[model samples]
Target: MSEMVIETSNLTRRYGKKISVNNLNLHVPKGSIFGFLGPNGAGKTTTIRMLLGLIRPTSGQIRIFNQTLPKHRMQILRRTGSLVESPSYYGHLSGYENLDVIARLLKVPSKRIDEVLGIVRLTSAAKQSVKGYSLGMKQRLGIAAALLGNPDLLILDEPTNGLDPAGIHEIRALIKELPAQYGITVVVSSHLLGEIDQMATHVGIIERGHLLFQDAIEKLREQNSPKLLLQVDKPLEAKRLLQRAGLQVSMDGDILQMPNQGLAATEDVNRRLIQAGISVYRITEQSRSLEDIFLDFVDKEGSL
Candidate 1:
């Protein structure tokens, strides 16, 4: 069995009458990019804070690196790196200088500074002042700082927030490579389902302080069964024929809709329709997008 780098059970956090996070359980496997997803005010940040031991949970437990949190906070933090929301950078200092300051504070060797800069592809901009850096550069610099400690797990909260399309893509690519290239487990929080679909190996979705889904990205894709749409000479006859053939069928106006069982089933359907003298005008296979699945889960749960 694969090791779980981060795990939480019934984790809850409340601000007086307002419950921020309600009974959340997260399982992040080692060396996998785990995308933490939720809408605004979905308690993602609160959960992250609790994980870092910056705040105490209202109830439940947290474990990281196979040890319980708060009790092992110092030990866990030594092997974890994080960048939450916006990163603070000194405007007057050059990028290299900023990292040097952090290295000195963390007692990290000076050589590790250059190595991290290269990892984030910021070596070229190392001498450039942070004030002149683009938003993407600044974000990458923050990640480089996070990597300074050579942590086993990396946590990032909306690392691409407030960036343009190109910046978002750059950060996304960097994040996708971290687990494979650097052997680090990552927990990235984002509200954008499309972005998460591209890079995350696993995902956990939260809405209105409630967890809606948590599983591998492929498992989530499996939930969205493909459908076949047929335009035939007689929609009613086609629907009835498919139903009699032990296939679930539905009519949408002049078209017949059925589950896309695969090539053999499609061939069977075509053969049966042709035998019935029904001309098949067109057949289209439609697969649901991740956005569709996300919306369905959120809507079904009524987590506005």
Candidate 2:
């Protein structure tokens, strides 16, 4: 079995009367880019801090690399690197100088600074003062610092928060390479579902402090059953026809959606629609987006 890099059991956190994070469970597999997803104030940052032993949880347990946090903090931290929210940098110092300081703090060799600078594509700007660096450059520098220790696990919270399109793509490509090239397990938090959907091998969705789902990206896609959209001139009659054919139909504006259980079911519905004289403007299969899936789950649970 693959080793679990990060696991939490019934994890909960509260701020006085407000329960910031309710009973939550998560399992992040080793050597995978695990995407942590949630809207604003969904406790993503808090949960991350707990895993890093930066803050104590209100209840439940957390284990990283099979060892409990806070208790085995020193050991776990030695093998982990993180940049939460925003990474701080000294404006006057060169990129290399900043990493050099961190290397000294980690007791890493001075030569390691050059190596990290190269990894983040900051070698060219190594001698340039950070004061004139662009937002993307600064972000890259932070990433370089995170890699200074060559940690086994890398946790980045909103790593692409302020980048433009090209910068975002650059950072994304770098993140995708971390697990494959360095054999490092990565946990990334993002509100951009589309981006997460593209990069993550595994995912965890949280809403209103509760964990809605956790599974492999492929498994999640498998579970999102395709539905058929019937765009017709007469939606009401079309819906009735589909229902009469033993197909469950949902009314959305001028569209009648029915679950596509199989090819036979779809063919049966099409035949029925034709027989009913329901002019089908369009009949298209619909795959729900991650945002759509998340909202449905949260609203169903009354947690939205």
Q: Please list the C-alpha lDDT of all candidates, in the order they appear.
A: 0.93, 0.87
Report clashes for each candidate as comma-separated counts.
Answer: 0, 0
Q: What lDDT tens digits, residue by residue, belong to model 1 across residues 148-255?
A: 999999999999899999999999999998999999999999989988988999999998778899989999999889999999998998888888888999888998
Instruction: Quote the lDDT for 87 in model 2.
Output: 79
- Candidate 2 lDDT, 1-304, residue by residue in tens: 7689999999999999999889889999999999998887888999998888888999999999899978899999999999998779989999988888889899999898988887888889999999999888888899889999999999999888979987788788888999999899999998888778878999998877888888898877777788888888788888877677676889978778778778887778877878888777788898887678767766765743
Per-prediction TM-score to the true structure, in the order listed? 0.97, 0.89
For model 2, where is the 10-residue window of minimal lDDT? Answer: 295-304
Candidate 1 Cα misplacement greater than 4 A, ranges = none
RMSD value for candidate 1: 1.2
